[model samples]
Target: MRSGASRLDLLAARDARHALLVRHAGAGHPALVAVALNVPGEEKSPPGAEPLFRWALDQVIAALPGAWPLHVGDDALGPFALLASRAEAGGAKTACVAVEASHPAARLVDLDVYAPGGTVVDRAALGLPPRRCLLCEAAAGECIRLGRHPLDAVVARARALLADAPA
Candidate 1:
């Protein structure tokens, strides 16, 4: 909650996401898709974010017709949805990745694919290159871990990306 402003909130959000995966995995879904916007700063649900999140969710649904929503709502961590799908984990990951790579705004949406065992299906598992940074060609995770960019700068870039995105 609180848009992960503190460490505890971030942990709580992570736990909540894991719980979603576990709950759906138990329901016999072969794969699960989790969607959430990558808005920077403590203000995850900033103005304009929810609508962009909705658009991204719609893209995911269109990509995976077999997927059905298990949960869809906004919280301290911003707009998010968890869906259980009959799609195979690998194929689902591929589709989600395609969505993520399709547009700049799409890149700001985290479309995670999960296996029935509650483990995320990473890009490496599908032989895809790691995601690139929003502002550069470096791996996104590496940029995040190294603090290669300022928070405000990332936020501004995100805003610009969202502005260019289809409403």
Candidate 2:
């Protein structure tokens, strides 16, 4: 959360994201891509985070054709960009997953695909493997749920990844 956003603010941001998905879907876009940095800790929009967010947005734009931004702004969670895509939901998800899994720095960005009616097209639904942990080979969700890594370590790793990212 940026500027000490409360839990309620975060929840509101989540709701707004869902609303964006529904709006795009209602407009006949088969899918929507929500891009946000996977930076750890409360100061999500940290000093160097926005550039990485922009990089991630560029990567998504390059990877998926016919995808264009529907919304781009900051939220309680941090900087985010939403894209509306005409590609089938499954295909759009697959392509987004590819973008996320393509590089180490890319893993620092979450590119989620949402179908019509605000249904998220998750990797499992498409039979893709779960995302791996930033610091280990274990599943990312599992590591996160278990609090397997210290927040500072995760943040440091994220910074390293960002530092190593191409210009």
Candidate 3:
């Protein structure tokens, strides 16, 4: 895949160790993003995951909260910035999630919660720590950004808020 979309299609995602989920209310649109790792000994695919990732973004977005303004994303930072812009422009709230892999909430995406666009944000803005994955730990060029908590943590909180929503 040449772009984020391509990255999604090309990725044969394995289970993630954890994940986080955030819930936003009253937003025009809601979306989820994840980042996955490439197994060490495994061979490489094409350049970027733009197309595959973008398409997957759309699917993931559809699976989230809001009913309108459906959107997909690649190039994690840029898209998220756009989301922030869109929400601000439209005066809509966003549910930011961080699910950890160590818990049940991280079960989505088989615990990987892998998304190209979302990963960069948590890494760049939140100060995520080093990855526990052996492949990432050993790789010299690998990026261990998005030091935020596992996806399960985020998902648990979001689910709680959603379950107890006002009647």
Predicted model with the maximum TM-score = 1
Better of 1 and 2 by TM-score: 1
Ten consecutive residues with minimal summed lDDT in candidate 3?
13-22
Q: Per-residue lDDT for 80-147 in model 2, tens only?
A: 98998888889988888887877778888898888876788999999888988989999989999999
Ranking by TM-score: 1, 2, 3
Which whole-number lDDT from 0 to 100 does residue 115 have in model 2?
85
lDDT of 3 by residue, 1-167 (tens): 22343444344221111112222223332233332212121122222323322332343344443423322232312221122222221112112233223222222211122122333333223344533432234322242245344444543443443233221
lDDT of each: 0.84, 0.84, 0.28
Off by over 4 Å in 3: 1-64, 67-97, 102-119, 134-167
Per-prediction TM-score = 0.91, 0.90, 0.25
Which residue pairs in model 1 clash with each other?
none
| Candidate 1 TM-score, C-alpha based | 0.91
Give model 2's clash tally. 0
- Residue 94 Cα positional deviation in candidate 1, in Å, after optimal superposition: 0.6
> What ranking of all candidate models by lDDT puts the best one first?
2, 1, 3
Model 3 clash count equals 61
> For model 1, what is the C-alpha lDDT against the true structure?
0.84
